[model samples]
Target: MKELAGQTALVTGGTAGIGLESARLLARHGATVIITGRSQQRGEAAVAELGAGVRFVAADLADLESVQALVRHCGDQVDIVVNNAASFPGALTVEQDVTSFESTFDTNVRGAYFLVAALAPAMLRRGHGSIVNVTSMVAFKGVPGASSYSASKAALESLTRSWAAEFGPHGVRVNSVAPGPTATAGVTAEWGDVNDELGRALPLGRTAQAAEIAEAVLFLASPRSSFVTGSTLHADGGGVAA
Candidate 1:
């Protein structure tokens, strides 16, 4: 039997990169996966690529109304949630605009918060569910141009612990996965060779792949991690340790 048979998973920002890979893995394990993205076109393409057992939902995590609508659409069928949607505006603190900072927080922190707030009650009632937040190594180690992004992820990590404590007792587990420099299309496009450069500096000597990070998400989302909660699994090529 598949590990996630009969489960339903919702992966935010799942049109591409780590989010898309995570959705693929969950569906491969027999979960009905719902992937969300701001573009209906991309979402539909992703669903088509992933084939059966995966569907797409249109959502903009930076918008509260969209987030709420997404929650309503999912209703109470979500057995797993992957908070993978985030906005990465890389700018020095002095150079960072207010709009960029707010947008980062709105998508990364506020969106995840409300999603959990709305979905957790159902998990509590059912007495079993998992939430895996896709954080970043910047939350643990400072990065030159990631002030807002880092802070947002740090906030999510803190919430992971709090949610774990609040929901763990009720049989719902919450945790986080922090990835270092990864060679995703967006990251590669934005950072160019910087990701590879950073990866070489890490203890593992290479940047991570989207699929590698998705594997970590799969572990936390499945019963394989039944006893794990409130902890951060660093899939960062040992960047945090280095």
Candidate 2:
């Protein structure tokens, strides 16, 4: 039998990149996967591509109403929650505007915070669930032009520990996966060759693939890491070490 045959998973920002890959992995393991994205077209495309047992929900993490609507749609049967939706607006600290900074936190931190707050009660009631927050290595190390993004991820990493403590007693596990420079579609589009250049500095000498990071997410979401909680699994290509 598949390890996640009887489970259900909800992946935010799951229409592409690491989020989509994570959804694919969870579904492959037999979980009924629900993916969310701001674009209905992309969400439907993801569902179609993923095939049976995977569905898509339209949501905007930056909006509170959308988050609530998403929670309502989920209806409390999610065994795994992958908080992978985030906004990365790169700008130096002094050059960053208030709007972008707020938007970053609203989407990356507040959105995930409220989503977990709303979903965790159901997990607590059932006494078994897992939450894997997709953070970044930038949360630990300083990165130029990524002040807001890095701070938001750092907040998420902190929340993982807090949530683990709050929910672990009830049999729910909360952890985080921090990926370094990854070759996701969005990253490829935005950073172009810079990602490769950055990867060369890492000990592994290459940027990670989305699937590689997704595998880490899968481990944390699955029973394989049943004893692990409040931990940040670094899926980075040794960027944290270097």
Candidate 3:
């Protein structure tokens, strides 16, 4: 039997990249996966690629109303919630504008916080669930030209600990996966062929594939990780270690 048979998962920002990969993995494990994105077109395409047992919900995490609507639309309890939606606009502290900072936090931290708040009660009632927040290595090592993004992810790391403590007694687990430089379309578009640079800088000597990061998420979300909670798994090719 499939490990995740009869389970249901919600993956935010699942239109592409790591989110899409994670959602696909969960579906493969026999979970009914609900993927959310801001773009209906991209969400539809992702749904098509993800095949059966997968659906798309359009949502903009930056807006609280939209997040609430998404939660309401889900209705049923979610066995796994991947808070993977995030905004990554890099800017040095000196160059940072209010809009950029607010938008990043609104999407990355605030949205995730409320999402867990909205779904965790249902999980507690159901007596078993997992919440995986997609953080970043910058939360630990920091990064130039990414002050707001780093800060937002750092905030998420903090929440992982807090939520784990608050929800563990109820049989719900909250954890985080922090990826280093990943070879996603968005990353390549922004950094431009950074494989060699990351290969030299990271201990593993190569940036991660999106599926590699998704594997970490699946581990944390699975019964195999029943004893794990409140931990941030670094899928960062040893970026933080070095």
**Winner by lDDT:** 1
Q: Of models 2 and 3, which has the larger TM-score?
A: 2
Taking the tens digit of each residue's C-alpha lDDT, what string does model 2 give over 104-131?
8999999999999999999999999999
The TM-score, computed over Cα atoms with residue i paired to residue i, of candidate 2 is 0.98
lDDT of 1 by residue, 1-242 (tens): 99999999999999999999999999999999999999999999999999999989899999999999999999999999999999997788989999989999999999999999999999999999999999999999987888999999999999999999999999999999999999898888766887788899999999999999999999999999999999999999988788
Model 2's alpha-carbon lDDT is: 0.94
What tens digits encode model 3's per-residue C-alpha lDDT throughout 168-230? 999999999999988888777665655447646899888888999999999999998999999
- Of the two candidates 1 and 3, the one with more favorable TM-score, higher being better, is 1
- Residue 162, model 3: lDDT of 97
Global CA lDDT of candidate 1, please?
0.95
What C-alpha lDDT do the candidate models reach, one value each? 0.95, 0.94, 0.91
> Between the candidate structures 1 and 2, which one is better when assessed by lDDT?
1
Q: Candidate 2 — which residues are off by over 4 angstroms?
A: none
* True lDDT of residue 10, candidate 3: 97
